[model samples]
Target: MELCFFDQVKAQPLWVQILLVVGTISILKFSFAVLNWVYVTFLRPGKNLKKYGSWALVTGPTDGIGKSFAFQLARKGLNLVLVGRNPDKLKEVSDGIQAKFGKVQIKSVVVDFSGDLTEGIRKIEEAIEGLDIGVLINNVGISYPYARFFHEVDEQLLKNLIQINVEGTTKVTQAVLPGMVKRKKGAIVNIGSGAAIVIPSDPLYAVYAATKAYIDQFSRCLYVEYKKSGIDVQCQVPLYVATKMASIKRSSFLVPSTDGYARAAMRWIGYEPRCTPYWPHSLLWALVHMLPEYAVDAWRLQFCLAVRKKGQLKDSRKKE
Candidate 1:
């Protein structure tokens, strides 16, 4: 009888093998990362949403989910003011929102988010010119060319992401928060992604995830400190909402419509505190959470292989 060395008892234990499978699937399947994130962060229930701000200001209102947020709020009878870098797109979404919500007073304010965040915010200060601003939705965000990795990124793009992710958000929040506090009635909802909580090892979008990490931590702290004064601070961690940010994948289980995320966002209007948009994704998220760090790292390598540079000249992957 010949003994086969390969068929001998598996070197790794059963639990370790299970973990390996989870990690492998996580990297190969974006849904794993998305699901894990939905579990860890989205499990928290929200607050009472009936009392929405009468005058709502939503940044990044020109593209992706931000535009949807402005429209949905308008539909809910809240007077909306759309804010973004592009004046044309701003006007476009503004026109459509006004046409549909006809009665809702919708306004547009344009400012470059990637520029000096503080200076751009000053322009917004001028837009309102101090008229008791009510709701502050800090929705501006960007993920530079998908091809660029962390060290490969240029100084300009790095600065751009930081400005929008950290500085722009902080400045706008600072600008509007005092009034919301003074009035003792307001809500501040920061748009964040599942990337913030999961913090994947994928080098493809290292900085982008870091920026969102700041948002998750930042909003949670704000909620704890300020809810007493009637200010609601919440973070909506959605899976990849198909928007301009959808450069990577368009129709994965991980990627849903901006309209879906927008509706899910309204569910948190009063807020249970911090909840994910889609509820059923919790199961996928839970399984991913139990994974060990080493396994997650190896799994991410598979993700890198899946998106390597095809270098197609005919049509760049980026969408205008």
Candidate 2:
């Protein structure tokens, strides 16, 4: 009988047959990855915020990605509890949301994550009392003014980074989680960074990266723990957005504007334990991982060193 393709392959040498099987498996895995990416990026419908609850609480809502998220949530017909250090900025954001989305209820909460969080957290608890806060955005965080070696990191900067990024997120989640658990439905989106997940390691910005890594693990644990209670917890990682925190003045294809990133982010809420929501950023993240670990490390080191140099020069000019 004439041999078919599989029969012909089986007739080949063992080593050649093994190679063919491995290649086929690899091709199939790559194809599936591409299909999944396309589905997530374009085809999936975002869950309804109304289903979760009517109110969404966003931390650091005065500027950057947090401010954008507040507006986007309001657009989705969700009332907002805006949290930030600056009361004026928080009020301004609330007003803006109210102006654009008439009939949207807005409340502002002033809490400095870097300062005495005990009082701030108490305030937050009071503000959201008796309200069905369906979504919580753990967005209040601080990063170094510029990259510096671990030894060069000041006491205050280290303290602030931990207190704000790590402790604040923990406390705020604690404050809101009970309400969610009791109600049996909620969503929590923690903002993480590519420094923690995409690259092999962050060289100069060690502590900052470590804090974000904590957020990633924390989110995953909560995701598993609370999923049965009908709550969705996610750590949304992004590479870069044009924001004051990143010191990027203009948005590009790779770096999205705050509004742009927030819009993409909303679609991803309540979905994945960890996600890079911006489609283009996902492509860049994939490319970064495909490179050798040593290559990524070297590139990160050089890039951060340049940032350090520019920061030093800027400081010197200020002293002058």
Candidate 3:
């Protein structure tokens, strides 16, 4: 049989033989990748979060992805430490969850990530003092109000972006890390952005992208540092979820609603150190990477310029 196959290949034209060999290898490689994606995305079982601990702490829990995560965690019977800047909003979210999951315990902490982060994180540490907080969702982050050139960014906005997105995440993780370290088992999920990962460049939202890039690297480092300690650290990169920050009010196939994104996100915790949770976003990420970086960069710049024009128009209308 081997001699017959060799004879058949020898009989074929040189180019045809080369094409067949390459085509078979390519098909097998592509098939394996597709199967792996399917298993990871759909077939793989999610970790039983309860095993991590009984309580989960989430930041920015008053709205958007944070809010959805809070509700979902409650649904899973995990007690909560809901942290947000506004006390009233925190109370409201806490009350809503308590109402639905009457048996679940809930605690609220007021933390303004932009103002006096030391105090903010102190509040978190204090609130979680006795709780077995197995999960820490560093979901609090800020983005540009709208797109603008790097030079067009104001001092206040720039300060807030760095303070809230970068420093805030770092401090909160520091406050929570010791407890998890002592317990020696926990999951930490830092919310990241496609601006830093999926796209070649986020032209007008430069600082926001940079901050998220820091988060990606930061999470990777912690993952390696803590894996042996039974702590799972991850950075979740999501693209264009329909949220107020994105200025996208309506959810669509590509733009998942906050709840949808959180649902997908929950499945990925304690797994990959870096991941795009929403499957559609993963598809988008893959497509973006296939294109030339230069082309993507140019397209991003033009898109941001248009966004800036529209934002400026809205500002003028408000003033008028």
Candidate 4:
């Protein structure tokens, strides 16, 4: 008697049956991933900021992504505590936020991340005293003046990068976390870089990437530790934005303006341990990961070399 197709399939080797089952599961998993991506990218509702807290503190709020975060958070009806190295810039941002958002309260704190962090953190702690700060944007960070080999990095730049990026973030988070723990509701958003996450390796920006990688881990650990405490910790990784730090003077579809990036970033807060907020940047990240490791390394090397060349020229012109 001839076996029917279903009987034949059942009678196949156990390994073959296992392979079929695994293949079906893998396909389903991929489909679900796509659907989830679509939902998050376009359809998911953002959490209400007021649910987290009445006030938000933003570091490095004088310019770039930090400044945009301050403005966006103010628009969301949350009061602002603006922290930056420049007192004048901080005051200006505070005044601007107050001017536009009439009912929103604003405070400015000037603390240079690269200076005496103990003193700066004390100032921050004092400034937020008695205030219910529900959101903390650990956005203060520094990068290379321009891409250069690790061996070529200047001593001052090296120290500043570590101090400002790693130490500053850690200390500021420490300052705000106790209050969040007490209230059992808060959000911490650490600004990270795609150089650390997307690329196979960031060739010349070694120190910068390492510091951001630390932030990614730091945020993840805190996320797990604080989940039960009603606190959310997230690291937002962005490839590039049209900001002075990135040396990108113009915004494009891929590289959004600071305001554009911040607007999307605010929507993602209190959601994921790690996220690439801009949809286009997320697509770029996916594409980068699809390429071969060697190809990615080669591309990164070329890109960093170009950055180094431009930086050297700019320095020479400045010296003249």
Best by TM-score: 2
Question: What C-alpha lDDT, on a 0 to 100 scale, does residue 141 get in candidate 4?
Answer: 94
Model 2, runs deviating above 4 Å: 1-3
- Order of models, best lDDT first: 2, 4, 3, 1
Model 4, residue 299: what's the lDDT?
A: 88
lDDT of 4 by residue, 184-292 (tens): 9999999999989888799999999999999999999999999999999999999999999998999999999999999999889999999999999999988997899
Question: Which is the winner by TM-score between candidate 2 and candidate 3?
Answer: 2
Among these predictions, the greatest lDDT belongs to 2
TM-score, candidate 2, is: 0.98
Cα lDDT of model 1 by residue, 1-320, tens digit = 23453334256678877887798787878877576666544564544332545688899988778888887878777787788888889888888987898888877877788866667777777776555566788898887555445677789889988888888888888888887888787888887777656435545667887888888889999998899998888887776566766564464566667777676677665564565666544444455578886787677655644454542321365442
lDDT score, candidate 3, position 224? 100
The TM-score measured for candidate 4 stands at 0.96
- Clash pairs, model 2 backbone: none
Which pairs in model 3 have colliding backbones?
A: none
Task: State the lDDT at 59 in candidate 1.
Answer: 93
Model 3, range 145-245, lDDT digits (tens) per residue?
89998999999999999999999889988988898999999999999999998998899999999999999999999999999999999999999999999
In order, the Cα lDDT scores of the candidates are: 0.73, 0.95, 0.93, 0.93
User: Cα lDDT for residue 135, model 3?
Assistant: 95
